[model samples]
Target: MKAIIVDDERLARKELASLLASHPEIEIVDEAANPDEAVEKIEKHDPDVVFLDIQMPGKTGFEMLEEMERVPQVIFTTAYDEFALKAFDYNALDYLLKPIQPERLTESLNKVTIKSAKSEGKDQKLSSKDQVFVKDGDKCWFVKLEEVRLFESDGNYIKVYFDKFKPMIHKSLNALDERLDDRHFFRASRKHIINLGWVESIDTWFNGGLLVQLKGGEKIEVSRRQSARFREMMSL
Candidate 1:
């Protein structure tokens, strides 16, 4: 894939570029120091993917996205673990922490190049569907977008409820809502977000909210504040 390195530090950029050089599938088209330069180079190069640094001088990586009409697949490179969590909330293609490991980088590349292709053929889309990488202790799963029934707030982390598993990921529900496509996932209450596609039944509940049951038998309560929109979205 055509790619570019965007980092404020020259040494950091060089290090990632050098490692990327070993992969024949990845071709570095250009490099940029800050968001502005990155934007310019991106428009000029039109690379297939970007290795973006979250913390830059003027604008962070997210701020750079507003300048583009269409964003390419992004693999964020950052030192802060907090920012990496936020990056995942944005549904970024992948995240590589600083002192990037070769195995991790290879795995991320495989996801972007091979898994993404399979996802496209399998009908996963940015607006209507998505896949989330969930790692719980020693277990890992590449969860399909449709299978996600609900997302619950768990202190500083969000607990993803799907199938028979409930995995706690280091992200807030608000952040996850912002990343999720509105057409598929909606904030049903202060602490819960539900996937519309997974709702098997809906009924009016106390305080003007609605009760939703998923195919997997999980019952989620949609709060009164969002009930009106929920009804409209469900055409009721």
Candidate 2:
């Protein structure tokens, strides 16, 4: 698996890289001293995993993640105490203290390996007739796919809109797009996926795109690249 080491401290980066040498399965493609470099390298290499430091000079690890559209498997390296770390949701990914233990690193890598293996076979997308389980905080709902009017990307989460409630779930918009049945839902833009059945009208938009108004009172702009295809699909 390709990996990138991101830390403001040079020593920390070097130490992590040295330790990672033993694991031949993980190749250190590049190293970054700050979030900008990290983001650039991440986009360029598209590594399988990233060893990211939680604290940095300008942008923190959380902020870096927020800037990214598609995030890879992240194993955080932090100096924060367990009590303080509880305030933020790191999506149940493994985290290591500043002075990371070798055995713990091995354990985290094992978990990542198992997780990656499990995700490789789930290729079938969810159809319009399928029901999806959504949970946000303490509330839960099992909503049928047809009932959902929209799926909006909000930072690191996706907001699922159905009836009178909109619940947020931690997921990537692109990943959700891949899992959804395209015949029922349409990728209107990078930030939105509108239910085709809920679309009320369509009008000409800027740059040869389309402005779509859904029954739920949402106005979504389909990108220029996706507009022609949208026209073709919606046409007789």
Candidate 3:
């Protein structure tokens, strides 16, 4: 994937570039010294990812993101850990502390590669076999599609229910619906998409809707508009 290193220190930029050289998947397309320069280069290169420093002269990394109309996948390269929690709120791909560890960098790159391929439509659909890396705050998980029981939309984020943990990831419901394998998952309502394998019971509800319960004991209302299709799929 194409990338740009945005840092104020020349040595810091060089060091990161050197480490990235060992990873064949990452191509260093450009470098920038400050927020202004970074913004200009990012628009010019349209890189897949940006290695951003949290602290810069004129602006912080988060401020830089606000300036972009279409922000790409961001991997924050900073010396502070305090901003780690806030970084995920921006839906950053990963957080790499300054003087980055090679192992950690590789882990972050793996996630970026998986996400980048899916975003670029290199993968038509994600099946039950596909694994996704999800990060909420400082916690992270590599979960297979089959393991998720429900996806509840909350504004711009989706609450992903898997096993016993419910973690939120930054993504829109409509965008995710297009990529999911319909045979294994169903969009039951405007706010929910459920895994068919987890359904435990189904019953009639108010206004021609259906009340569906999962093995995990969570109840979901299948919209009146979607109930017919749900019945058809279930009966099939």
lDDT (C-alpha, whole model) for all candidates:
0.77, 0.79, 0.82
Which of the numbered candidates is closest to the native, going by highest lDDT?
Answer: 3
Residue-pair clashes per candidate: 0, 0, 0
Tens digit of lDDT per residue, candidate 2, span 1-236?
88999999999999888888888998999999999999989877767788989789988776687555445677889888663267233233577887888888898787554223222223556666654556465344445678899999999999988888888988889988987889989998899998899889999989999999988888899999999889988991
- Model 1 Cα RMSD, 1 decimal: 8.1
Alpha-carbon RMSD to native, per candidate:
8.1, 10.2, 6.1
lDDT of 3 by residue, 1-236 (tens): 89999999999999999999998888899999999999888767768778989799979776676544345667889887776665454334688987899999999888775333333334457777555657666555556788899999999999999888899977889988988889999999999999999999999999999999999999999999999999999993
Q: Give every collision pair in model 1.
A: none
> The CA-based lDDT of model 2 is what?
0.79
Instruction: Give the poorly placed runs of model 2, Cα more than 4 Å off.
Output: 87-90, 113-236
Per-residue error for 138 in candidate 3, Å, reads: 8.4
Query: For residues 113-223, could you state the per-residue lDDT of candidate 1 as single tens digits?
Result: 432332232223344434445655534444666778888998998888877889787777886677677899889888988889888999999999899998878898888
Q: Cα miss at 100, model 2 (Å)?
A: 0.2
